[model samples]
Target: MRLAETVTFGGSDLDRCAAERKDAATLARNLAEGGQVIVLWRGKPLVAGDPAKGACRLVRLGAEDPILRDAEEGAIFLGRIEGQAIFAMDISGWTPPEPVDEAQIGAFLDPTVQLHPGAPEGSAFRELRAIMTTLTARDAELAATARALGNWHLSHGFCSRCGVASAMTEGGWQRLCPDCGAHHFPRTDPVVIMLITRGERVLLGRSPGWPEGMFSLLAGFVEPGETIEAAVRREVFEETAVRVGRVDYLANQPWPFPASLMIGCRGEAISEEIAIDPAEIEAARWVTRSELLQVFAGEHPEIRPARRGAIAHFLLENWLADRLD
Candidate 1:
């Protein structure tokens, strides 16, 4: 796990200026001088060129960029790099030029890309998952932060405590209810995705609605009082009836598919039998390391590997190369 930070969305080293967020004057000055502003639309980030190519990258706009005027909310400070401040803004209020299929939009890694008339030439808004692996470490974190924070503000417009509408404050990091003295912060649900192994085979499962032949490491949310180790064991047992004996943390990635922290773990399975709960997963099976190699290469006949940017894929890649230690 020494190279944990190398995982997508984990190694950005963003200098999130926590103290400056509270200083109104300093924040205003930074916004005035900050030239790096990443734009998102309906949870999709704006990128330039063909993201499938190595040369493609994010197009972080200046603070004065007119496209940012359509942002439904205020600018969010996403830290800095080399003395230049970076910000993220969601222009979800703007509509795309073409009529989009509501069903295909992120239903399964949304293949549809959108272009705005005012956006930069060759720039288009695309689902972050589609372009996450192609982005630099910095852009990956920026997109994750933007999507997660924007989703939080959109879904949490009301105070849970008093059922009152809240206002964005603290540089879009905190929400304050005017009626009550309630304050809310962004939420990141911790999910444990375990690589369960028995001898040379690893446990894999496909959810009920996943695309055909898709399988991934078993995963579930960490309950309120459960530890990481306990969550891994419980989730594996619950989903596949596989009892995990020992669990160790492997790495973590900021999965902003609506704000999640994917905690990758390695678990030694004491049992090989898989009795998948139909309600939890559509199918469960064991695959050998050799089979995994085929799956990663897109040569496997039945199963495709997890998405490239996912923690599951990262863990599997390292495990295959004997770099998990």
Candidate 2:
């Protein structure tokens, strides 16, 4: 897909200074010199303004900011933006003054516009997924990087090899285990999300607990020792008993709901018969181009289009418009 990277959260080419991450003294200096920080509370980013107008604001702070006093761990160096250093701090343990809104669509809620005890009054922790489509490319990339790296540090605090707790090192890029001398890096699980085509129809499936009428491309995690193409084929077969062939890579998106790399692909379906595995998916079906266009137009009563900002939606939209070249 020529315009593949134009997808939401796909195009920002931030200079992730990998080499600088290893220099503790430089990182400390950056912090001491008043580097800006992005704050994440319980995996939700602090937003400062309205998201509907394409200004999904990210709260940036300085090192001595009062909010950092209660940060759970040292800041993660997130690289430089326009010659200024960027960092991420997590204050997951801090209690919010207001109860979190549970009826929000995504994992976290857009906090009430009120003053927290120690934080800025206008800022509110909001789920990245809930506002991803509205954010600028830079904000989306930065938030995704922070959320992914932060989630890794939170979940992989223990060493997998020696069963020992690991300490954060290398500016939150690596973990060091004292007991086993093992070095652990942040993990990004690769998932294959493929659009399977048989003539004029594309395959889509719905999971068990998904909202009624919601469906998306068949996707599954890449198993160990499995190639991306192999994973795509395996996932399609496992979920819907649809045999896929001639797989081709399309585009990718950083899906930071607990850290995943969504590898988008297009696959040719050799067999049209769908024998859906009830355990893997609640339902599976193939829809024609016209029918999908209806779905996108909100005219299909039985199916809701894939959520915007997701790679699935991106792929399907491009495919419908014949732009997946």
Candidate 3:
């Protein structure tokens, strides 16, 4: 797609300096010299006041602060945001004690804060790419990593191998069980979202809990020992009773909403007979190009486009622009 990277958290040209991992001293020095600082208090992101008025944009720090001390671990280099030294913190496996003192925290969240309640109303959170560029791009990515990893720690505190509590190790990347010494790492489940097309119509479905009129591309988690191609075919056929052929990968996005890597693909539907698995999808249908255009423009009262910043939206927008070949 021509605008694939334009998706939220999609288009970042940050210099992820991987070589600096071995040199802790050098990395710390570099971070200190960097201009913008992205802070996370506890697990939730600390937005500077709020984003509605846009008062707390990234700014040059006059001096060092307590948050930057030893805050780096499982933290990777995100790109520069407006000449400020923007950095992300990976606080996985570490939960903050209760009684959050609002005054002592920096913004802590993946780039998806705008979608949640209490964040400013009537604001856009789906265009992560747009919001990312407006703030610290690299810092946003790093914060996302931290949030994802931290969530994993919260859920996977007990070792699956021996059913014992695990401890954070390897700089927040791996968890070690004190009883069995089992090492666990954060997970990124692969999900395939395909824009299945048969001539002029494309396949779309609405899950049981989705908002009214909201539909998205057919998707499913890739099972163990399954290729992306096989997963797409199985998912489409199982969900909508459509036989898929000629699957082609389009793009990928790191969705850290609890940790997922969305794999976008284009598939050809060999059969069009719609017989949805009533348990999985509430409704499934074929949408023509013109109908999709109306939905995108909010002219169609019966259908709502997929959430922005998602791979489904990326595929749909590209399909509209004639770039999804």
* Candidate 2 off by > 4 Å: 100-115
User: Which sequence of candidate numbers ranks them by TM-score, best first?
Assistant: 1, 2, 3
Give the better candidate number (2 or 3) by lDDT: 2
Q: Say which prediction, candidate 2 or candidate 3, comes out ahead on TM-score.
A: 2
Candidate 3 C-alpha lDDT tens digits along 20-41: 4446455456566753444443
Candidate 2, pairs of clashing residues: none
Please write out the lDDT profile of model 1 over residues 110-158, one tens digit for every residue. 8898988888999998888888888888878888898999889889989
Predict model 1's lDDT versus the native.
0.88
- Worst window of 10 by summed lDDT in candidate 1: 49-58
Q: Pick the candidate with the highest TM-score.
A: 1
How many steric overlaps are in each model, in order? 0, 0, 16
| CA displacement after TM-score superposition, residue 256 of candidate 3 (Å) | 1.1
Model 3 clashing-pair count: 16
Candidates' C-alpha lDDT: 0.88, 0.87, 0.66
Cα deviation of 130 in candidate 3 (Å)? 12
Q: How far does residue 260 in candidate 1 sit from its true spot (Å)?
A: 0.9
